[model samples]
Target: MDFTPPQKRKAEESIVPMINVVFLLLIFFLMTSQITPPEPFEVTLPVSETLGDAESELTLHLSKDGDVQFEDFTGETAWMRLGGRIDPQTVVKLRVDAALPAPKLAQVMQRLSPTGAASVEIVAVQK
Candidate 1:
């Protein structure tokens, strides 16, 4: 009887195909994902049953306490600063907190009117 050592078996399956598939899935998700810019402040947007498309280069944020915040400015000063920089025909996107009262909303609109903006679009989440 011969006492021979068993030959080592080689791996029959290669993991290269599995790795390629995983990489392909990763690339697919990266391409399909939508990335939104982070807001300067937290805001609770109002919900709407109907959706509308409103796009603008300028955005104004309103807080629950009736305080308006803009790029590096807050309150009345923010509006003033925006008024000078924004064009008269530009559309302003107003992102106001849902908790804000109607009067406050009117006040903001009143203030915005002087800027000569063509229109103000209130941003809201569609339900």
Candidate 2:
């Protein structure tokens, strides 16, 4: 038999490029993805000088027609869900439509007070 050892095959192909492409695709998707959930209904937010992003864990939405919605809840069910989620220190975030009447808003606020929320943050758009 020949004394020479068999010729070695070429080294395994590098996977670095594949890994980079995968990472790039992942980043692209993340950048284009929507982080927040879709609104239950279309709402035109009022303008405010102190506009800020809504980051509250417990969010309540009020439509122009005085419809209240919380997550998948509505009407009395929404209120009950909101009340149950509130505590002595929980700050509830309210997204009220710009066209909502003042009296309707007051009624909502009146209902909210007994929920035991320490504060209510009304989210609005910047001028």
lDDT of 2 by residue, 10-73 (tens): 9899999999999999999999997988999999999998766666789999999999999999
TM-score of each prediction: 0.69, 0.76
State the TM-score for model 2: 0.76
What's the C-alpha lDDT at position 52 in model 2? 64
Taken over the whole model, the C-alpha lDDT of each candidate is 0.88, 0.92
After superposing candidate 2 on the true structure, give the runs of residues whose Cα lies further than 4 Å from its correct spot.
1-16, 23-34, 52-54
Candidate 1 scores a C-alpha RMSD against the true structure in Å of: 3.6
Candidate 1's displacement at residue 86, Å, is 2.2
Model 2: worst 10 consecutive residues (lDDT sum): 48-57
lDDT of 1: 0.88
**Which of the numbered candidates is closest to the native, going by highest lDDT?**
2
| Per-residue C-alpha lDDT of model 1 across residues 8-125, encoded as one tens digit per residue | 8987998899999999999999999997667877899999999798899788999888888877788778878888877877999999999999999998899888888999999999
Look at candidate 1 and tell me the lDDT of residue 12. 95
